[model samples]
Target: MRIKETIYKWIFTIFAFASLLFLVGIVVVLFKEGLPIFKHVKLVAFLFGKSWYPTYEPAEYGILPLIMGSVWVTVGAVLVSVPLGVGSALYLDELASYKQKAILKPIIEILASIPSIVFGFFGMVIVAPLIQRIFKLPVGLCALTASIILGVMAIPTICSLAEDALSYVPRSFREASFALGANRWQTLTKVVVPAAGSGVSTSIILGVSRIVGETMTVLMVSGGAAMIPVSFFQPVRPMTATIAAEMGEAAMGSAHYHALFAIGLILFLVTLVFNIIAELISRRFRIKLGLNR
Candidate 1:
């Protein structure tokens, strides 16, 4: 028993060390590639300048359009997914019958398990054409279309994580609310939901990370237009899509290639900040729940 326990501990420690090394490796590579953008382009020009015509003779490196497009698509996706995902989670956690949960949980998990490429294909074939036909637009591949696909993809993750969080709330808490004459809905909204707020927030943050990192789906549906999106119906190119579409063709060691890495660096930093914020919020929520004690 002691030998087996020692072996398991060593294996777990090695896995953790490997994960840390992988993350450090990514950070080092991104920084090395991203730092060169300041050589030919001013920091402000790269960060805030609106134009993104990298193919121009002078090779403009303005990343604002891509940044704006990424933000727009991610926000749109979250707007569509958050309420629905949270509501579905609440339903599954607090109200669903055992049989219903048995059916619904697997369905939600299956949705998440579906490959992202398959989702992209579905968006390209079905959602885009529908939008184009309904709106009489030139093409349905746009920020809105991408948002809808990303929203669908995020739903399963948010729902599953949020449901797990809600499930962790003690039954005594619900019983106390019920004993106080609160209805099931009131108990859920005021007590259980608040108790699980940290977990739900964590889910949202995770979903944000997933949305930001998504490359193929956004590339397929976002029309690959490297311009600032004035409206959801207009074509836009997210940072991930730009990287995916251009990385293959960008000449190695060129300014354009470095700029793409810079975009990735920005995305990674933003997601890291959100993750840190989520961790802080989660800790605070645990204290509120008296679980930190």
Candidate 2:
């Protein structure tokens, strides 16, 4: 039994090390490929440049439009998902009957299992046309459409994570609140939610990261226009969408190729920051709750 345990430990350690190595390799490759854009385009200019005419001579490599588009779409997705997700989690944990939770949880889990391409197709076929009609826009495929789709996709993740967090709160806390003459709403708001705040925040951060990395759904519904979107109705392209849309057409080792990798590096760093922030906040919350011992 001791030998078997040692073998299992070795297997887990090897797998963890392998995963870390794989991530480091990808980051190294991305930075190496991306650093060249700074050779021709100044770092400030490359980041803040409004135009992205990479095909033209004296190739423009301004990534501001893409960055802005990514921000707008991600914010929209978060706006749509966070409230709905948190509300669902609250109901599941605080209000819903066991039978209701049983029905809804499976439905939400099923949503997570659906392929992204299918969501893309649904956005293209159903959402795009509706937006065009209502907004009278030139194209239905825009940041708003992509945001709506991504928001729906992020729901299951946020809801599940937040529910788990709420569940982790001690039952004694709830009973103490009740003993103090607190009503359900008061207990939930003053005790339960505060206790689970870190979990809720972590869920939101994870949802943002998931939407940031999404490619195909954004590409299929975002009109793939690499321009600064002044309005939600206008077409825009996010970094992930640009990489996916142009990867097949861009020549290997070309400037455009490097630019794409640069965008990828930016995304990687952004997600890493979010993850770190989430972990830090979670730890702080645990300490405040006296649960870190």
Candidate 3:
């Protein structure tokens, strides 16, 4: 028994170490390839320059438009998803009976499991045409369309995580609040949600991260325009879309290839920051709740 246990522990430890080793290898490769772009274009020019005419005679490589595209879509997605997601979570945790909860939770998980390309196809054939007809726009493919799609995609993630966070609040907390004369609504708002604030916040941040990293749906529905977006109605191209659309055509050792890697590096950093923040929040909350000894 002892020998078997020792072997199982060593196997698990090796798997864990392999995962870390792969992560470090990816980071090193990303930096090595991405850093070369600076030799062709100055850092500030590549980051903030207005034009992205990489194929033009002068070969401008500014990524400001791509950055703004991601920002606009992410912000719009947050606005559309946060309220609905959080509300669904609250309803599931506090209002729903056992039967309703069981049915809805599985539906949410299924929604999360649906392929991204399916969402893109749906957006193109269904949502885009609807938006164009409703708004009387020249085209339906724009940041708004991408935002709506990504928002729907993010909903399952937010709802699932937030519901789990709410479930983690001790039953005694609700009983105490009731004994203090708080009604269900007051107890939920003042006591329960506050107790799960860290977890709720973590869920939200992770949802935003998912939005930021999305590629196919945005590429299909976001009009594929490589210009800074001034309104939701305007077409925009996010960094991920740019990479996906152009990487195949860029030469292996060209500046354009390095530039795509640079974009990936920026995206990697942004995702890392969001994850770190979520982890910190969850850890602090766990320690405060005495769940971590």
Number of the top TM-score candidate: 3
Q: What does the lDDT read for residue 262 in candidate 3?
A: 97
* Model 1 residue 187 CA deviation in Å: 0.9
lDDT of 1 by residue, 80-158 (tens): 8898889899889878999999999989988888888988999999999999999889999999999999998999998
Off by more than 4 A, model 2: 1-19, 288-293
Give the whole-model CA lDDT for all candidates, comma-separated. Answer: 0.91, 0.90, 0.94
> After superposing candidate 1, which stretches have Cα over 4 Å from the reference?
1-19, 290-293
In the range 1-293, model 3's lDDT, one tens digit per residue, is 99999999999999999999998999999999999999999999999988898788878899999999999999999998888899999999999999999999889978888888999999999999999999999999999999999999999999999999888888999999999999999999999999998989999999999999999999999998989999999999999999999998999979999999999999999999999999999998787666775
Report the Cα lDDT for candidate 2: 0.90
Best to worst by TM-score, what's the order? Answer: 3, 1, 2
The numbered model that scores best in lDDT is 3
Q: Candidate 1: give the clashing pairs.
A: none
Candidate 3 displacement at residue 238 in angstroms: 0.6
Which prediction has more favorable TM-score, 1 or 3?
Answer: 3
| lDDT (Cα, tens digit) per residue for candidate 2, span 115-207 | 889989999999999999999888899989999999998999999888888888999999999999999999999999999999889988988
TM-scores vs. true structure, each candidate = 0.92, 0.92, 0.95
Supply candidate 2's per-residue lDDT for 36. Answer: 81
Better of 1 and 2 by lDDT: 1
